[model samples]
Target: MKKVVELRCGSVDYFGIGAINRFEGIMEQYRKRGITRAGIVTGKNSYRLSGAWDVVKPVLDKTTMEYIHFDGITPNPTVDQIDEAVNLLKDIEPQLIIGIGGGSAIDASKVVAVLLKNTGKTARDIYTGRFKPFEALPTVSINLTHGTGSEVDRYAVATIPEEYDKSGAAADCMYPEYAIDDPGLMLSLPGKEVLYTSLDALNHLVEAATTKLSSPYTVMLAKEGISLIHRWLPRALNDPADLEARYWLLYASVLGGIAIDCAVVHITHPLEHTLSAFRPELEHGFGLTILLPSVIRAIYPAAGRTLSEILKPVVPNLKGTPEEAEEAASALKDWIGGLGVTQGLSDVGFSEDDLPELLKYLRKSQGESGSLSLAPLPVTDELIIRIYRESL
Candidate 1:
């Protein structure tokens, strides 16, 4: 086995076959640390549907720790909703906050934790570059979905609806105290969810590996994540009951998260953020599906070699040299179509008429000093417009 040593973030992670069974033990650890009250943040139905709530409730009851359930979070959570959660958290004044669900819930929990401690900083203040908190309430992240890697990372993304912006904040304090990733919880996901969420992980890996900041360690992690997603996502989608497939995909998501934490995601994430920010109803993975192929084509000249290497394990029959960017783009487009996600912007209720407004949002989200600057090539308004039109 290949062995390497690198400095990782401080979050304690627990995984494997029956890792989630240790949920109560983790809660107990917090309780022993003098946590008197706790809050559970999650989505409307995912907490119960994924059976995480069933496992967590008894622990709170048995430990006799006062707890509140904040289940109002939605996909691509808005600034207002996060403020609402923060207000509740302030009222409850929980000693600990546990985020259980997909990326949105976890991210919302992170911001809530930060804003709760930094009473002067509002959600709007954080998003608008007005305030940056240096501390946050202790947090534990329980991941129900295998994508987003929000469990172990220090990134929290939120949409500012009034400004038509979706942005991410990163701080050392944003990292969770513990991240619980249990594949067993993933078995309850619908097939489409399996595909979409896995795709999100795959995108994270690709974007992280291709960014200018990628290092040898991060690249290796990204490659492994891509290979696992390519192999296991289809199987998990075909058979939702397949624990092995779910386990591997969850593993891949963890790798993807780590890779992005080290190297960071580039163009694809910002573009997807624009979509979800405008249409809060858009599933992140679906927006990625529509834009990724075109974005690949646009950036192939600068990112060709990395893209080729990343896709090689996915498409074994892939031909052409690494410099032939179009070859890699073509193969990736075909693979995405094979996964049954061929809808364009038109399919997602977007049209040529929406392009001007979309470009405005894109410019705001992908400003020169923002995440878009990390793209392999300089991302411009003209290029973004072209990519959006192509995706349509």
Candidate 2:
């Protein structure tokens, strides 16, 4: 028999609510671990919406540790932005880093933490997956948004601006030492932004469950996230101030992130990333919510049997044979389409004129991204173009 090697699982410390006034108490737990100075990273919009500055300021002020603030982090962080943050961090020189806001800020902080230690390496170097795991700066992420799970994952996604392409870096080293989930911050999120992120988390669960690398551990994460999303996402959408609904969605988001570490995203994310890079106005979650149904239809034949076997009880009308499974998967796609995210590319303002170039970029770009290879089927530039055309 061939030997199978099991990867070691790591631990995460989660602090839910009371984080605003009790942050100092949480830090006391980490203080003995040789932590000192800390840096705060957030985006301008999130800082204003969450009132994070007011909440975090007093915590830092009371601590003996020096605080450095970097507000340059942007949504869908780019390689240049990361490099710029690295340069700034060299000047600030903190031992610990706290990322406050959405996944973008947290992801940017993860890049900043690792890049600051490497000094000379570019984001591409890490993207290549060749770097040895190094001890990262002690980091904690305060999550404001309900998706992207940057709090738990070692992955940091950044766009390489010169190429107008996305790249990701993953190493166990980049996982935050602590994560705080506060529902209070989510109360201020715009209704559309909340729905966008909620859909993003839903896609994460669906894709992770269907991905080839899925295992027992990731399956549980994916299932719980999906179930919770189905249960509470609508409540959250209808009542933004419902802290209970927000908590459920937020926890579901973390579950999805943990699923990524175990099973990873396959098709929807890559296609959506391509769309977002090509058109910045299209929101990331909207991209996934739109493209996912199509991608699901494409991959159903290959993966449907396994999915049906797993989802028959949980997903209505999915059971028995491969053909049945395929039908069930298709039905699920229809249900998702009911969510109003299946709008064609044209609906989103994408013209046919953009197809050839975007398809070319996807084909060439797939060579550099591991996520593309994870698709259920072997993908080609022609295949990607066809999908785009169908989406239109």
Candidate 3:
């Protein structure tokens, strides 16, 4: 039997079945703050189609709070998108900001909240540190998918389409003040999204468990998260309406998010950020799935013991060696392939010719998130190229 769990991390998160009830309490707090205007950030359709808008609009109405929304959020949100959203949302002078979709939408909402509070600051200005603000407007995330833990973590990512630069930032002010994760709301996910989001959560577990700062907390959360995903992801995909499965998968995602918040995702997130930048069409989780096995092999030297322990759900008998890492990577590839995420970087329009540029942006991208430093070993140019080639 699953019970509703309320976790207080940087953000207070409500996870499990019927967790949507907590939204009223959140809005009550805003009402008491005399927050009259609310700004919403969500994708074009998922906000409505996922049944979130139907469930949330009434609460705001009861509070008699005025609200405005930017429904233009997309899969991989861009700098222009965020800058434009900030420009549009500035008219309302919102006191509260709510991000109501997956990572892309929630990440954009976090960026908008930051821009709104630090008036006249562009998304680029804050992300690049040309204008570093000490505070941001309080925000909430009504998380719709089970992948990105953006609701609970202080990190946000967006791509610069023109320069092919993807920006990721971690700051104290970026975390949502309140968040929701209701499994009932997750039933609207399509098959592809269900697989992709679950893969995203699984990769988070693997990478977070092995970072240089892997604490007992990180490893414990990651192991349980990975195990839950293994047992439940396929069930949800097979029976898309499985509330129990959705509960566990979303719970696992929360665990992964909290794990990464403490340990931080290292090499995989850095490289995947670059991959999606190279080809913006590639989904974040899709890029992670394609490169995960290669990442599993690359980090083994530094993280073998951790990998061997947490990964036992999939590769049950791993002995945690260089040879076993290869075996584990192959096994993971086969597992993910079975779920239909078999595309390599080449399949998604990346090639050897893009190598030099990918490297240049990767260097720039790594500096902000500092994910590369947390890696067990130096992710040299040669090794990066090798990982790219192997994924190809």
TM-score of every model versus the real structure:
0.95, 0.90, 0.95
lDDT against the true structure, each candidate = 0.83, 0.73, 0.84
Off by over 4 Å in 2: 1-11, 19-22, 128-133, 309-315, 320-334, 337-342, 366-368
lDDT of 1 by residue, 36-146 (tens): 788778889988888888888888899898987788999999888888887776777888889999999999999899888888678888887778778999899989888
By the lDDT metric, which is better: model 2 or model 3? 3
Evaluated at residue 294, the lDDT of candidate 1 is 84
Q: What is the lDDT of residue 211 in candidate 3?
A: 77
lDDT of 2: 0.73
- Tens-place lDDT per residue, model 3, 130-150, is 776578899999999998888
Better of 2 and 3 by TM-score: 3
| Candidate 2, backbone clash total | 0
Name the runs in model 1 displaced over 4 angstroms. 1-7, 317-323, 366-369
- Candidate whose lDDT is highest: 3
Q: Estimate the TM-score for candidate 1.
A: 0.95
Backbone collision tally, model 1: 0
Residue range 1-392, candidate 2, lDDT tens digits: 24232222342546455555556666666566666677777887787678766767776766666777788887787777777777776776778888888888898888788877777876666654556548678778888888878788777777765565665677788888777777777889988888889889878777776676766666677667777877787788788888899888988888888777777788788777777777766788878877765676566667775455444434656544545634664566676665545567899888789988776666556323577676667767776776677678
